[model samples]
Target: MKYRLFGILAVLFFLAWQTLDGMVEGDWGRLEGGLANLSIFFKESMWPPNWSVLEARSYPVCEQDIEFFCSVGYLGMMETLKIAFVSTILGFIGAICLSSLAARNLMPLYISLPVRIFLSGVRSLPSLIWAILFVIVIGFGPLSGVLAMTFYTVGYLGKLQYEVFEGMPSEPLEAGRAMGLSKPSIVANIVIPENGNHLLSQLMFMFEYNVRHGTVIGIVGAGGIGYYISTYLKFLQYDKVFALLLLIFVVVVIIDLLSLMVRSFVNEEGDVRKPTWLNTLLKAKRSKASLVESE
Candidate 1:
């Protein structure tokens, strides 16, 4: 155990040394000076957020101006949300189909093995690289972002869904077969219902992740809030950049809360209970009463 601990520490120290060496090689001499300037820049640019800027509209000066003159910040935010939503939904559909085929218990090795390999290949690439590839193929737009998110979602959700399906109780599936249910019927009636809550939870979590990723993909000209973020930072408009960052933060928080609520509703203890704090308290009280009565 002591040797194992020492080996782990040695590896960690080596990694840290390598990282520091890389940073120094990349020129750390200016970093200290740059940090002081950065502090001043942040104070001047981000201290007073322009809340009214999101509501301000640009006057139409040209065809392109007319296309995006109304509430630039809000419109960008909406586009980001749309990209995340559409990609997640499309990817989830694709994942469900692929997961059914990929489950080892449901399909033979010949069928499932190839699918597992394909999904692994897909999962190997990061979403940013996928976005860049799509942008190269399709040109700069939300289409690239959507395609990137969709493909990444399929890779991620497929693996998780197949694992869930494989771990599911096989007794119900056998019972369905004995009752003369078809394969599709058995999966639809038995497998899905048993894992519905878990699947939904995973989907919601993926959507939340995609929303955060959507903002990043737009930096590569994929057309969302990230595009504006990149633009503002390039022009040194740190106030606008900070505002966009705050907006993204708020959106993420809201989605996280909604996902939590959905999980609570679907995976409620015992029966299908209301996902409310009061309901939780009520359930606790009832359980305590039942225990007393039994005693």
Candidate 2:
């Protein structure tokens, strides 16, 4: 069995390599000196990132005691976070409604089919295209960004949620039916509670996805840090762009940590022992004792 698995993987890798080679026209030499070129580019254009992006603009009268509070990095990042938060929440609500209808186990085929088709249509357009469309429809701003992200999130998250619902165990649904619970009641009590962990996981993932894409959409004048990034790129201000990218990286890291902490609460809830604050403290103490003993 292991040998068969290895053989399958080897064939898949070979096929992938062949496909890539075909696309590149077998010009592997193009990779030669790539590292050296990147090094030179970084040194000449992006090294020693400009910290001025962290300083408040002169035209903006300094109302705050700290300049960083009014800095481009802070404002842009906060705007992006706000846009992501609002859109994720709106999209999650919309997705839950649609997904409940679309899930095969939750709804009849006639209802699920049309809703699935609609979700597919929505998901067909990339978020970037949605942003552009919204910008054209409503003039540029955060509003356009919000609308674009919300639409994309609904389609993407709806598919994930409905699939999760369909994959749920049949026993609770049957029990709900036996209990004469209506569809809404079943969904609220049985479906949602059973799938709480998965729903929360998808919610966090979609928020993170929207936050990253917020930068991309902002390049189209939808308002975010990407607006400043586009401006810097236009002026060949690679150092400032690099600094902004670093700031984005830091913000994304913080969001990831936040997601991890939030998910930790729900992760051990079912058959495993649920962790409380006191239990967590005790566990930490136990770990410290174990480490000391090993030492």
lDDT per model vs. reference? 0.84, 0.90
Candidate 1 clashing pairs, residues 3+ apart or interchain: none
Per residue, candidate 2 scores C-alpha lDDT tens digits across 171-288 of 9999999999999999999999999989999999998888899999999988888888989999999999999999998888777766665666887642344544444546667556
Per-residue lDDT of candidate 1, residues 1-295 (tens digit): 9999999999999999899989789676776788789888889988676554475455543344444335667778888889999999999989988888899877889999999999999989988989999999999999999999999999999999999999998899789878999866876888888999989998999998998998899999887888988888899888888888888899998887777766777685635445565444465686676678789
Instruction: Kindly report which residue stretches of model 1 are placed more than 4 angstroms away from their true locations once superposed.
Output: 1-41, 61-69, 270-273, 277-295
Worst 10 residues of 1 by lDDT: 60-69
User: Candidate 2, which segments miss by more than 4 Å at Cα?
Assistant: 269-295
What's the true lDDT of residue 92 in model 1? 93
Quality of model 1 by C-alpha lDDT: 0.84
